[model samples]
Target: MLRLYESSGRKISARIALGWEPSEVFECNLLEEDRCPVSIQGNEINAAFGAYEIKSYYLRK
Candidate 1:
């Protein structure tokens, strides 16, 4: 899991990939708390090439 946060400490988002599944997509509100259960919203993302494919998102300030 990759954690992303805003500079003002207001919002956060995490990215994680489990295997190569073309049918999977996700999104969610950025959460700072580690112990709390985080809920993520699902969005459309695409990946090509098989095996250990890396997916990344960029956070803009």
Candidate 2:
């Protein structure tokens, strides 16, 4: 299983989906580090995780 969350955490998006419900989100463990690969706009940190493939749309403030 995998966990997914919006920028602010809401019901609009799925906080936790299947390991690869849409075949996009997946849980990966590197050595002793676990990553979910969450995509955040304008953030380069996520780029390294391939989060750039997924786009999070801000519906409201």
Maximum-lDDT candidate: 1
Cα deviation at 33, candidate 2, in Å, is: 1.3
Clash count per candidate: 5, 0
Q: Could you estimate the TM-score for every candidate?
A: 0.20, 0.17
Give RMSD (Å) of candidate 2 vs. truth. Answer: 14.4
Q: What is each predicted model's overall lDDT from 0 to 1? A: 0.33, 0.31
* Clashing residue pairs for model 2: none
**Poorly placed runs, candidate 2 (over 4 Å):** 1-32, 44-61
| Candidate 2, poorest ten consecutive residues by summed lDDT | 43-52
* Per-model root-mean-square deviation over C-alphas: 13.4, 14.4
lDDT tens digits, residues 1-61, model 1? 3333334433333344434433332333244232333233343232232233233333221
Residues 1-61, candidate 2, lDDT per residue (tens digit)?
Answer: 3222344433343332222224233344423245445443332113222332333322111
Which pairs of residues have clashing backbones in candidate 1?
12-30, 13-30, 26-43, 27-41, 28-41
